[model samples]
Target: MKRRGVPPALLDAFLVLVALIDTWANVGFDRGAPLGCALLASFALVLRRHLPLTTFLLTLPTALVTDAVFATLVALYTLSSLNRHRVLLGICALTYAVIDFLPWPWSNLRATELAGTRNVVHILYSVASAAAPVFLGQLVQARRELSLRLSEITEARENERLLTAQSVLAKERAQLAREMHDVVSHQVSLIAVQAGALQVGSGDPETKSAAATIRRLSVQTLDELRHMVSVLRASGSRPTELTPQPSLADLQRLVDGSGIEAELKTDLPGDLPPATQRAVYRTVQEALTNVRKHAPGARAIVAIHHMNGTIGLTVTNTAPTQAPLPLPGAHHGLVGLRQRAELLGGSITSGPTSDGGYELHLELPIGTT
Candidate 1:
């Protein structure tokens, strides 16, 4: 985790206070040029961040006139940390060293005379002092750069991980779509073809009607399967054409083709929305389907009406006249219907009635539909 440091304002104040103390110790409050330059250098530290070069120039006069060197060293460090030009930093450091090494009365001194061992030692110490702050500042700048690069690297890795996961999911969906096309569609097509043949071959009126009904249902199932396969192949990468759905207008046809005695009594507004109409139609279809499979020979009533500000849909069936035969079923029709209703901001409640029958209720707000 990254650690927080002192606030910028507070740190700047602390630096100025330290500079003032250094000024007082080396160049006391004497009425002279040395004291004035020292005071200017100490306060110039305030401009180090915004005007680092200017701050260094202001502090140079203090280094030449007095022994108070803390503010000058700080100004040099600040310039080094903020600037990328090495030549400018080198010139500043060398100037600082030379200024601090020469004594007060050096007008008569020559380079050959300064070749003494004591003079050389003092010059070396001054150079080292000037170089210390530059090195520390460079280290700080490098650390800040490294932190930024690490954050960028972490973000790139997260994006790569998400892309890899999506690729795997797309592959799985493609495989499923292939299986549906190759196996399920082929089987359903054969059912439709056989039902067609039976309808034509049968001579009895009732048998022919039954065969026709079977063929119609088989063809409908094939259409839905084809659409589902196309959707799986798309893998949601782009928009796929929506299959035509049954609205309120198709409700009567659905009940007639259900192969069950179902009555659809609707007292609804003429301006019902497509989504609400679809939901109601689907709920009634599922209810009648259940009555046919689980409650054979039972009569069903589908009632849809507007009550208060809500639209109410109810499907109820009487008790079966005979025991139903065992049949394979996925039992997902009602669950799917309830989920669809909920998606449309509606609710569904379904259970057995006290008269030994099944009933499903759906309620939806007119405004939300």
Candidate 2:
């Protein structure tokens, strides 16, 4: 385990202290030359972390003369841990072994005295002192590299999981769009055809008007449904050719076909954007559909008022004279209209009128494509 709370400077000072004590014991401090070499070797420990090779070279001469083993061991450990240069480590280890084993004029006399009987023990001690620190440093380096690799692998797995989830969601959305186009579109088209036939066959003005409203609304619903289906199918692919969306000009055909007594009032620009025109057309269609379904035989007034930077639409119906038919309602028409308006940075509201009828109001920003 690594020591905590001990700063590097303090550790270096401790190594130097240990080296000084060992040098004094092995080679007397009374001799100026041997004492100076020992002090210089110990001082080199301060440079171990920043300049390990320089520190290792400085301690070689002292290791040959006196027993300044602490400073030599610390310098070797720093060189192995920080530099990671195998060639430099091999050269330093060889130099240290030669210096430690070879007899010299300034050699530690007490250690050299057991040269005959303790030769093997002396060799093992010298090798262990030199090799232990380097081995420990390499182990530490290996552990750090393993931890980094594990972290990178974990991050890659998480990213892959997120991408898989997104792909599944996209596939599900596309499937739903296909189902709506195949099932709901066919039924809505049938309703429009039946309403058109009813309008032609009915003799009463109220019945004809109601039938006409249903037909127009059904057609508009189909158009919007087609657009939604196309969008879902496109996903990330190239756009497919779509039918031309209806605009304000198509409102006349809608009103005429509605078979109801309805009036449209507007002075909209001839060059209004396509999106704005579509929104206006759909809003009117939904309101008329509600009138046909809930208040049959009611006269509807559609008023489009253009103001500075905004377009306002109001569809108001008088009280009904005939009862509503028991036709199946999807019940999502008004919710869809509200979502459409909000998407264009606009709003829509509808409620019962005091005159026992219903009214819907829409405010959409102009130039919003």
Candidate 3:
């Protein structure tokens, strides 16, 4: 875009006029001196915006006195629009004014005119020079501030875009988890119902044994599926009509149902919230399930401690003699457990113990339900 202020052509024309006037009015062997000075001043003015400091220095001498009015104006405008150092600019202006009026032979003017028309002209020149530089400096500073603000706005928009991307990814993950739960639960529920029916009937030895195995597998799969759904549904509000979760009070039933004997000890606070109790229960449930699947016939230990607005649950089981069976899909139970813990500012840690045993530990803030 074309910039504001005087155009180059107009400025060039003004310089030509000033040069011609200086050369014609003065009678001397060095007739082109004024013309040369005016042209140089105009050239400096034109390039002032790009190199402000140099332009200010270039115009400081002759321009301070006689015919370099345009040059002085240009230097001031350049200094103000570019350099931020006002004190430096002021010092330069004062120096130029002092030198312009000094009673020196090379200066080609006398002290007699110091308070005359010459003085008026010098005063006007000083004011214009200082004012233009200051004005341009303010404009430049405002432009810089505006640029900074624009950069901040752009950064904020980029951050918002990233957050939106993350939230979308989280939702997609939740949807996939929900779909998996549906597929697995449907098959497992059908198997469980059929097995239950068969067990009530024919007592053929093979059929009875096959039915019992089916019932066990089906029940286990259903429980795992339910846990998966619970984890997936962690984002929304708590389920209003959800069945009460088993806590320490029902720890015995959990161990008995899993067919893995759990030696349990509880020092739990009576005032523990339903959510804390439930988290403890689920940790134990998952721990026992892992024991059955990966540590078959191994004894398990469960412990609960409540203190200082925190509830800590631990479950450890001896390792199985056989190799662990690989499970399909992501570990939704652990994912849900972590998500639940994070929601309540809690944590869970699980790993193989030192003596060929596996342990699960969970901590939940009290009154966080």
Candidate 4:
């Protein structure tokens, strides 16, 4: 309803200026009575925006008296622009037309005194004068409404696009998380099992200690992996409860399942925090999986050591005796393991060794549970 940027008072003043110019050009200043009436009609335009109907009614008498065409046109334009009532506008236009064309008090002549052709010409001109501004004002109002509707539609479509993009991104992330859970969890669990077997069968005290550390780490990794999977699954609807997660104790079963020659050495507290345990497990699991894939028939060594407020793990494999199996892989195991370590305030590094093998190392801080 409110006109933006254009002050009502300023617009009214502009309308007054238009009315004054129109009156000056049509009704000369030399004619005192007519000029005075024209001035009165022009001055009424100052309130056109605020009180358009009232201004139009006030100027109607002056328009009839002085025949000030511009003042009447200004009032009609103001009424049409406001677009309050079509019936009222039509009535006002009709009244002005009748008064302007008919031979009345202004012409000091009766209607019968005018010639038929002259009366017809005067009627047509008066009708056009009354109708032209109203038509233009209505056209302007329609265009403004159309522009506002288009703007709203454009904004709605943009918001819809933004929401759709966010939904697609969320779905992609959930899918990636699910894939990682399925592929890497199995490989990591196998590493834990292998480490557990080494701890139970090895004769050397150092070797048994290392095996124990690997088993514990693998079990913790399985637990965290399950938790991550649960989070992914919950991202969608149809939420389901997760099964009990693995712990340090489950590493032996994992090692027994994997057919690989591996050794583990560890000097860590039995009551290690869950986060550190999970980080160590994932590191060892990812390293062993990489060894199996890249260095078939290679012997792997896993060493775990606890220092001041931190735990360190190193997994290294000797050169393979045979070519690795040609297996399709997503190639995201290492990246996922690294991400896991970082999430737990830890770091992991891996590279090919000088001996044509591979080695992975991890260091995790033991933050408060």
Candidate 5:
């Protein structure tokens, strides 16, 4: 497939054009061998992507026979970028340096002449230049691989988040089932028993018939409740939620135990619904927990307000004064808190502050269930 922004065919054509220009600048038009070899190297770039090794081999003759080595360098870079064989790339680069440094005719290789200072410097320069393309290509390959790894990690984390959310929902449903069975069903059973006693003991026909109807309906309701309880228990639920949930009254105790320097200020009414109060308390709890975890020794401010039918909260923490010790966590606190806020018809917004601090904001409508 063609790439975005720059088409592959166009890029290949451009590379070939540059190679032709290099050849033109280096070789005289009257020299038949140099011109033919340089042209062959220049045209070979079109096959570099599919057959990098073959392309590099095709271009090597130009480096050996003439000064037009641009095509050879480009081909070497292409091969290094595509192939993961370090030994082969090293050999190819060394061979290019040797070909570029040596005298053309094998018979003219004199030991004393090759040992000169100027020739030695030229040889070192040739080796360095040959290694440049290979290094650059490998760097590009590394960056490309890193990007792919990061993408895979991000996708995996998203799947894990979804699973965690499903698990949380299943547990909540199971808890609801337990509540219905232990409380609502118990009350209904009591009413059914009382109705049965009235049906058997009452003398009035109308009252007896009413009692019988009530008992029958209550029994049917209990059967449906049992079925629902069974279905909920069969679901893949984890542990039950913690009992005796926190409330606004527990805000002070939560902060005192949070291990961070924090100040709480709020103007919320005392008559808020239990769920709304719990949401606020949990928001403060989670925010303070994060401050202690991520921003060690940082001062925090928890400000909550109720104005114009909106319950707004802001938890802001300063930059860490000391590095925090690494702690094992499921990283589910914020996910669960967000789920709670969403259920209450609200939203959570969080990010870094301008003073190198982190802030979390929760906005919920007043009296939301």
Candidate 6:
């Protein structure tokens, strides 16, 4: 409730002091009467923060009964600046009407010899007192509403800026993924092919030693590719090597060493595009890794089926004997994987399976594949 250049509490206290002074000035030497009115007005000021409506109600009666201009001004300002105008307006109108007709001590004084002169002064006093409060209250209320609207507009602009930043980030990551895939695939494939050929055909001991070095180099190159991909995906720095990415043909090997006795059934369509095949391979790789991490000691089943114009893959594992390792602070792994699949016009879902196991299913539409 602080305002520019002045704190709200301090401002309220100053207003209350002004109202008290006005009360004393208006009452004059009424033998403790002015003191009582000033105290009541000041006490009403303290209620401004928590019960502004009640404070306004309390002040309005004092304003109407007393001839204190500053007390009425403080009440009007609190209502308009701190509370809403519609309620303040209705209260002020009713209060003024009641005070105009009331049989007060001052009203009784205007009945006798000096009645004409006293009536003139009273009329002037009523016009100035009533009009000033109403005008100032409306002015303050309008300013408060304008400030609130401006704040709402500022918040909306900030949200738009945040959305724009996220969209730009997603596009940058997509471009990085494209560049890294192109660069690493060619280099790693060339190294693996050259190493395999030299290992089989070479006869010299030196050539044999060179082939072994090439094999180790090829493994290191693949590891480097994974690290670069993880970094680009905004997953954490640490790399976990689990079941390797399997092509359509590696279904048997995936099942054989999954650390659980299992079976794999595949009806993968031949002539699938290279990118689609890679996506499917990555999906299966992640699914198997999840099984090992979260469902250890549970026998699993892997299946890749071609149905209609889409490739569907499912991996299911029974409930594990022990709880899975707590995920290290790398929350972005699954998020990044889903983004990858979506870019290739595919979707993936992984969660607990019915019948006491977990399942992961991925689907890639044929046109995108």
For model 2, the local distance difference test gives 0.83
Question: Candidate 2, after superposition: displacement of residue 328 in Å?
Answer: 4.6
133-165 per-residue lDDT for model 5 (tens digits): 999999999998988898899999999999999
- Write down the lDDT of every candidate, Cα atoms only: 0.88, 0.83, 0.71, 0.79, 0.90, 0.69
Task: Please provide, for model 3 over 3-33, each residue's C-alpha lDDT reduced to its tens digit, 9 standing for 90 to 100.
Answer: 3798866875675456445434532225365
Q: Please report the candidate that would top TM-score against the real structure.
A: 1
Clashes of each: 0, 2, 6, 9, 0, 0
User: How does candidate 6 fare on TM-score?
Assistant: 0.52
Task: Report the lDDT tens digits of candidate 1 across residue range 1-369.
Answer: 677989877877888899888888888887499989988998898888999999999999989989999999999999989888989999999999989988765685687868889888898899999999898888888888888899889989989998899889889989998999899889888988998999899998877887888889888888898888888899869999998877888888999998778888998876788888888888887888789889988999998989887899999999999899898899899789878878888899988999999889999977765
| Residues 1-369 of candidate 6: C-alpha lDDT, one tens digit per residue | 347687778888888778777776776547475456556766788777677667656665555456664654566555655546576566664565446434455556444534577666766665556556666767777887888888889889989998888778867876786677788657776887898789889998877776765676677667777666666665323464444444666656655644455678888875787678777776666676677667766777788888888888888888887777886546565686788889988888888877779888888886674
**What local lDDT score does residue 298 receive in model 5, on the 0 to 100 scale?**
95
Lowest lDDT sum, 10 consecutive residues, model 1, at 104-113
Q: Runs in model 1 with CA error above 4 Å?
A: 1-10, 24-59, 66-71, 85-88, 103-121, 244-259, 270-282, 321-327, 336-346, 367-369
Give the runs in model 2 whose Cα sits over 4 Å from its true position: 1-137, 174-178, 192-261, 266-285, 304-313, 326-349, 362-369
Top of the candidates by lDDT:
5
- Off by more than 4 A, model 3: 1-127, 178-182, 202-246, 261-283, 295-369
Error of 3 at 271 (Å): 4.5
Q: Please tell me which model should have the higher TM-score, number 1 or number 3.
A: 1
**What lDDT score is found at residue 13 in candidate 2?**
85
Please, what is the TM-score per model?
0.79, 0.56, 0.43, 0.56, 0.59, 0.52
